[model samples]
Target chain A: MAATNLSERRLARFWSKYGFVLAVLVPILLWFSIFSFGPILYALYASLTNTHSLDPSRARFVGLDNYISLLDDRRFLASMSNVFRFVLVKGILNIVLSLGLALLLERLRRGRNFYLFFIFMPVVISQVAVAMLFLWLYDPRLGLINYLLSLVEIPPQSFIRSTAQAIYSVAIADVWKTYGYAAVIFLAGLLDIPQDYYEAAKVDGATRLQTLWRVTLPLLKNPLVLVMVLIVIDGVQHFTMVQVMTGGGPADSTLMPSILVYNYGLGANNYRMGYACAISFIMFVVIMAITVFQLRLFRSLYD
Target chain B: MTDISLDRRAGGSLPSGGAGADARIRLREQVIALVTHLLLVIFAFIAFGAMMWMVLASFKSASEIIAKPPTFLPEAPTLESYALILREQAFGRFFLNSIFVALPSVLLILFSSSIAGFVFAKFDFPAKEVIFTIILSTLMVPPAVTLLPLFRLVSRLGWADTYQALIIPVCVSAFGIFLLRQFMEGLPSELLDAGRIDGASNWWIYRHIVLPLSVSALSALAIFSFLANWDSYLWPLVIIYEEKMRTLPLGLAYLLGWSSRPRYDLFLTGAVITVVPVVVFYSFFQSRFVRGVTLTGLKY
Candidate 1:
């Protein structure tokens, strides 16, 4: 009786020590399991089978068929190439503009926040809203851009209407919306660098350009890597702005893989969930590969 | 502050330089400053001007919105577009639905993340590192990978067109948990220990001590998560079939298909309605939003 009572008392102590932790963590982990982990595992399984979006129970195993077909699939190829161009255009413009803005902001003696407030305003709004604004701005007939171009005697351009300019036009609008975010990140990274470094560079009589190249850029490697990877990942998975602006239109010129996934998985009479999942997995692998490549590249460049 | 010293250092002349050279250098610095401010003002104007144009366009008449040589200011500014959208599009319902989904989701994320962060920060438990790593790894998986499966799951649960469909899947953010954990770990443990010594329960100590001290991090997370939920589109588009069940973004997008041709007037008005509230909120907590960006590097 004495031993049993002692063991019960120890159990009570253990419960008292860990009850709250278990109560909090159990639900959260369960949530992750149900929502996060479960869906990922399900996608992996569904990608290998012929599944319908509405009727998963009828799915039949089809080994590598979807993956093999995607290799030659014209639309899939277009999406892959389109996303490649999208990431490239977005990464270059976003970096240059944001870095320039960051440098400019870093030099300001006053009204820094005021400038940032206006610049960062776009980052906070909805992608669809931005798309709507740009749609009007890019309107062939009534757009302000065309009107301004007419003032300069430049002919009106079909921004999203033409196949060639559609992707770049969408890219430009996205850049306008997102560059400020990278600017803020770069600005934060800039401010974190010690002023003593600049003073040291000055003592050596390094020109402004030399100081920026040898000192500032090297010190900013982390944020640069961060911003680049984010741009790549975001650009690769981009859907909302493109979907809202064009719905991958003007002869599939801007058909992103995410849009393809939606078209295949859920379009009326096109419930090819398995095919869509295959595309999603490809996108996943591409994002992972590019991200790792970027990290490795940046590491080698600076290290 | 640092700029002041930098300016002084730049303005200070070489010991061998004459007064003319000093004047020249001062002129050069002033020219650089002028050019810098000029370029910055243009950049700022471009950024702010587009949104301002969108706002002004919303009030113009339908024909004037798309009129030739587009009017910079609405010649006859009116509330007709707003009245049309509110009455015909049921935007008010969409607004309420957005609030209904976002408020609960943000609150739940905060509660779950902070409490879990508190546990991870203050407690020693088995498999803690393993669990945290697992959660963090999920951040790398893009939402597209899970889109189909989640749709399947939610539909299976008979939750399509339900508010829970919007709220539940996103309620506990991995990023939020990670952010709050990083924050709560910085909080002084002595305060928590003092509460413990006073025989307070872990819950009480978290409620009174950890929660209060974590206001900054919590608020940042709240703003970000709230914005994310408010701006979410694809999920709501897929799940919500009912007009009344739409979120703001969804309702705004539907305005495009509502008319045969592009209605710039209604589109701008809907956009104005969609964007103004967040911009207003952002105006108030502008620093927190910026800090949240640096803190989490989240792009909305």
Candidate 2:
């Protein structure tokens, strides 16, 4: 009887201490259940189905029709190419610009805060607003960019209207809006470098260029890798700017994978939900593979 | 540039009798400083100039905006566009919707994430490592992966056009919990022990000791949460169908899509209206914002 009482007391104490944590866990579990885990399961099921989002009751188990069809779709192929271009070109540009700005800002002794504040302003602004702003800025007739170009006797070029230039133009706008964030992260890494290293380099007659290449670049590897991975992920998942600015227009030149998913799943054609789900899954796998590979590569670099 | 050169020249003259070598070094240093400042200033001007242009264009008459050379400042600046946006477009309604949706979502994220963070930071429970790892692993998953599945779930629950659909699914943030947990773990354990010795309960310790000490982290999390929800586009775009239920970003997108021929002033005015609250909020919480990003970088 005494042993039973002791066990009961122990159980009561555990419940009393942990009851709140259990309560907290319930909502999180439900969130994962309904949103994260539930969707993933549903997406898997949908990927195997012939169901459209508009008419869910009509869904039929078609066994990989969507996946096989995706391989043959030309637009999907184009979007895939677009993603690669964006990931490589825009991603690299954003990193370089951000790192360059961070270095310049670090060298300054005065007005650092002012410059930091100005640079960071774009990051906090709504992407939709930035999109709209860039739309006006990219206006072929009255836009600032074209107007500036015309000052040096250059002819007006229809930036968003041209098939060749639309993707690059959209990428430029995105870089302007987002590279500030990369700069912020890089600045933090720059600050983390001990002043002693710079002093040591200077004492050894290292020039600014040499010190940057040997000391700063080597120490900045982790942040650079982090920013690169983030930019790639962000570039792949980008939607608002493409959606608002060009609507993947001028012969589908700027159609990103996310934009394709949105158009199929939610746009005017009504629910190609299953196809959308398949695309999302593919995107998920691609992003996961890239992230894992990059992380491993970075880990090896550190080692 | 001239001032820098002068300073360099004076320093060079005092340093050595070999004036030629010193002077050349000084000249090179001054030239580099001049070029660096010029480049930075030019970029700064471009950035600030673009923002200023947006503000000015929002006040210009439609024709003035499209005029040759595009008027630098509006000839007759008017509140007509602002008035039209607020009255005809009902941006006021959309603004209120954004506030109502974002504020509650931010509060929920902060409260729930803080509790979860406390557990992860202070406790040694069963499967702690596994649970923490699961939470961290979710960070690797792209948000797009959840879009279709979430839509299906929300539709099934008949929450497609409701605030619950907008707020509930996003209220529990893994990143928030992770950030706060990292911060909380850095706090000394002696304080919690002292509180226990004084017969204070865990809840009491959390309220009195932990919460106060974690104010900086909490504030940082708050700013991030607010900005994120305020600027959220895609999920809200997918979920909320009604005009009355739309957030700011979606509302702006709708306005852009509403007119066949886009009105520069009206669209820009809407953009400005959407941007102001966030800029104000950020400026007020600037220190926390910097601290948050910096801390995350250091840890990651």
Q: Of the candidates shown, which would achieve the greatest TM-score relative to the real structure?
A: 1
Report lDDT (CA) for all predictions: 0.89, 0.80
Every model: iRMSD:
4.0, 6.5
lDDT of 1 by residue, A1-303 (tens): 999999999989989988898999989989998999999988888899999998877899999999999999999999999999999999999999999998988778778888899999998998889999999999999899999999999999999999999999999999999999999888887777777788888899999999999999999999899999899989989999999999998999999999999999999999999999999999999999999999999999999
Best by lDDT: 1
* All candidates: TM-score: 0.96, 0.93
DockQ, computed on Cα atoms, for candidate 2: 0.39
Clashing pairs in 2: A53-A271
TM-score of chain B of 2: 0.89
lDDT score for residue A160 of model 2? 81
Docking quality level of the chain pair in candidate 1 = medium
Listed in order, the DockQ scores are: 0.52, 0.39
Model 1 gets an lDDT of 0.89
Q: What tens digits encode model 2's per-residue C-alpha lDDT throughout A245-291?
A: 88888898888888888888877865788887788878878887887
Question: Model 2, range B144-207, lDDT digits (tens) per residue?
Answer: 6678778877888899889889899888888888887888898899999999899997888888
